[model samples]
Target: MDTVAANGTGGDVTAKIAGVQALLRGLTILDVLADSPDGLASLADIAARTGLSPSTAHRLLSTLVERGYAGREPGSKGYVIGHRVVHFSTSVRRRTSDLRRLVRSHLEAITAETGETSNLVVLDGKNVVYIDQVEGTHALRMVPGIGSIFPAYTSASAKAILAYQVDDAQLDAVFTAEPRIKLAAHTLADRRDFVAALTAVVKHGYAVEESELAEGVSCIAAPIRGRNGVALGAISVPGPTQRVLEPAPERLGVLLKKHALHVSQALGFRQLSCAAG
Candidate 1:
């Protein structure tokens, strides 16, 4: 055990404890507010969500308001996250490698191996943005390039990333906001079907699409995860459906998973192998 006697009055220790508790409570309130659709929360709602008393929640919220991290709503008198949180989030996004710097090599390698177009996609508000791409040498090919946005539910790369990264509520929200509009005849239309497809992808460690995005194109996708086990994006190889489904889907799946793991390692994922029980 380690113990240090207070050099000054006990008030200092109590103040420090109170400050730490307030900080934790304030952060919890921020999280609740961020997750809400309106970005505002009442004190009772914050207290219920944070397991804090009403007075404690009020004090924590007041401190946050004083610090300019939260502001009071006019009509409801609820607290909403302020400008500081947005600034901090924007700074973090700016610091991270923006699409091209992160997945270019993986795209190139997939193109080289499969002689097909490769794409790197990230989630953007119910859609997937094609941030980077490498074209194949085929005479006729599908060419999705940077700045192209596609529905997330219909894209293999987007589904692969979403399966590992997003929660159930977020996934529900995505489907609710963007219902399946039939990009192709085989596109998943319902939540149950989509969930089943994602579950299969997670179990097999990769995803495959056959004529979902286009008439004759097929794609194989695998997730690229970071250190925290959250998927940053997905690496995909797209070609004519005949080539991908020719002999064995399992073999193609293996190749996709292997390359995905290599890219994930490059992106700082530390694989954890579980022991047999």
Candidate 2:
């Protein structure tokens, strides 16, 4: 308040405004460098992208590099995000609670839209952990006590993420990690069928669990990917099987994918764009 009071005059205000402008310019340079290919940017490229003069861009880039938000490439003259920035990024991502907080609002929105139970599930070790959920409007709903753990193969939420398994080795590891007791009609008949089913989930863009975990309960889920295109987690909407089947489960699948993408984007997930040949 004292600073503002002293700076209330026109000249002082102008000086303060100029200082703010300089700070914004420095941050803009960092943004450009962070998004560039290989996370490196040249001064000319930064100036072109930010529309700042060569001198102004260089001064701000220097400030950022000195402050550890950015750095110079070892061999080349290009700029990249500094160690401090990478440290903060990894620290935030390592906290499961931070991710839950970021996704809670989206879970609420999903429940509001679909009027069914909405959940955010993360793959913890071999089991899927329910970190967050929103109660739906329906009187009868799947209200599992929060923090419940379910096998990855039995629930749609985990299946959606496991569907993107890159190789048989990883799939086999997950299977070995989690014991699978054959549940006659619900469980996949064999490893071959399970692998084939997961491939179908990836191709279908979503996963469906029809009375797999609990009788009369069904769910549709989609994998949420991070900016690096890694599967971070999955979101799901589960309700009674009869209602899920009627009026087309595919419609719910579409809506689930839309919300899942929103959550993924909130987590700094970006879809890869294919360039025209």
Candidate 3:
């Protein structure tokens, strides 16, 4: 027994080494699949990329597919990253939870003051996704449901973040990836017009939308900046166009900016005024 444990021929030791090697090979396959431009790879391509035998690659890939880490692309027979991996990519969900905790009071205050539904949103890919909301007290209001997604260009919340982005390439990418569409009569469908709108957002220190996303609805939003001064997300108040655009758009814009700046400061973005002293 002692000699068996010393590494000559121990079943448990051999099993442990084999398990680790299999785990490593499986991870290598996953990396190759993820690195594909379209997130797909044929079995032959995966085997060649991983430098594994065809039989070994097939076995590992079969296990991966069975376990949901990979799946076959429809009609392609090529392995693609699975829904499980896509779900894992949303680890931002965890970060958003922390963000909601940090910003919930701000959302509530916006709702209380504006009598409009307030939302916390973050840019995901080329879209803005609502993660949290505080409903208005009024019977008539608009609340883009949590987990709702909207084109970045068509959303005031997304424009708030895009207006502060220092990377022009990112803005260009959004246009290149998705064709501009007229979601409503006032939608900024042309790239040049969209860019100008974002520029105005920066100049005005906030963003607004009047029936651009949905008819009879309007929104005002301000960016929440990170330590580097890039927007991490936005705080927005959206409501019936009559209420949101009535009284004064600037009034809502100013209120949103004040609270958004506070949230940005809480998140470690030091304003020039605060940094100067």
Candidate 4:
């Protein structure tokens, strides 16, 4: 009886090892499919690239398709990256909960230091979402509140993050949609002006909006970046227009930039400022 039990345990161990090896092989095939031009690859191509037998490759691809991490083209019988894979590739939704906790202290500190409303905002599609906010002491303070989303083109926080992004085509598509014109008080007169503003923001390490998104509100923001220089989010201080820039927004801009740098460094951005690049 003890010998039979020992044999069972060994069989379980062997099965686990085989399962892990199979998973690795499956991922290798998926990687080949993902890297293919047009993002689709024939079974023969995947089998050749992964050095797996044709039947083995087919089995693995079929399993991946069943799991929604891969798909097969009906006409061509080629494997492509599945919707589930693509969906997760671009979203950090699962990480946001943990990230928010890590960033909240920085937000509170920024508000305390500036004596004004501070926000932590991230780019979501063509808009920016305010994930968190710290209200100012003043009765007339400008507050967008948490979970509010605003146009990426007109928001200082959004612009600060967008200025570091390297996708011109996506940016252009968002700007050209709808009536194109945003707020009536927006200072950017045309697409050309908007492009120039982003360029300046990249050069200056911060962005500012003055009576643009709203009637009397203004804000200054700086980008928080990842180790790869991708803008993760932005930190901004908002207040009444005159006070935001009365002495010029430069002072607050500088402070925001410093805090942004600190938070970004904490997130593993060891390189020089994204503005420098």
Identify the leading candidate in terms of TM-score: 3
TM-score of 4: 0.62
* lDDT-based ranking: 3, 4, 2, 1
Give the Cα error of residue 170 in candidate 4, in Å. Answer: 3.9
Which 10-residue span in candidate 4 carries the lowest summed lDDT? 175-184
Identify the runs in model 2 with alpha carbons over 4 angstroms from their true place.
1-94, 165-170, 177-179, 274-277
lDDT of 1 at 251: 58
Overall lDDT per candidate, in order of appearance? 0.71, 0.72, 0.80, 0.75
Off by over 4 Å in 3: 1-91, 273-277
lDDT of 2 at 108: 84
RMSD to the hidden true structure, all candidates:
11.5, 20.1, 10.7, 14.8
- lDDT by residue for model 2 (1-277), tens: 5765666776788888999999888866765664452467899989987889989899988888888988999999899878776665445345777767877887888788778888888775455666678888898988663555565666777778776544455456556642354543586535676666676677767788887766777888888877655567888887898766558778778887887778777877666541110
Model 4 error, position 158 (Å): 1.9
Write candidate 1's Cα lDDT for 1-277 as tens digits.
2234455546678889988877777876776665443457788888887788999889888888898888899888789877686566455445445545766777777778778787776666565666667998888777755545566677788778877863665576568752245656677757677877887787888888888766787878888787666777777777788777567666567777887778777767767732110
Ranking the candidates on TM-score from highest down gives 3, 4, 1, 2
TM-score of each: 0.61, 0.60, 0.66, 0.62
For each of the candidates, give the backbone clash count.
0, 1, 0, 0
Evaluation by TM-score, superior candidate among 2 and 3: 3
Give the Cα error of residue 217 in candidate 4, in Å: 1.5
- Which of candidates 1 and 4 is the stronger one according to TM-score? 4
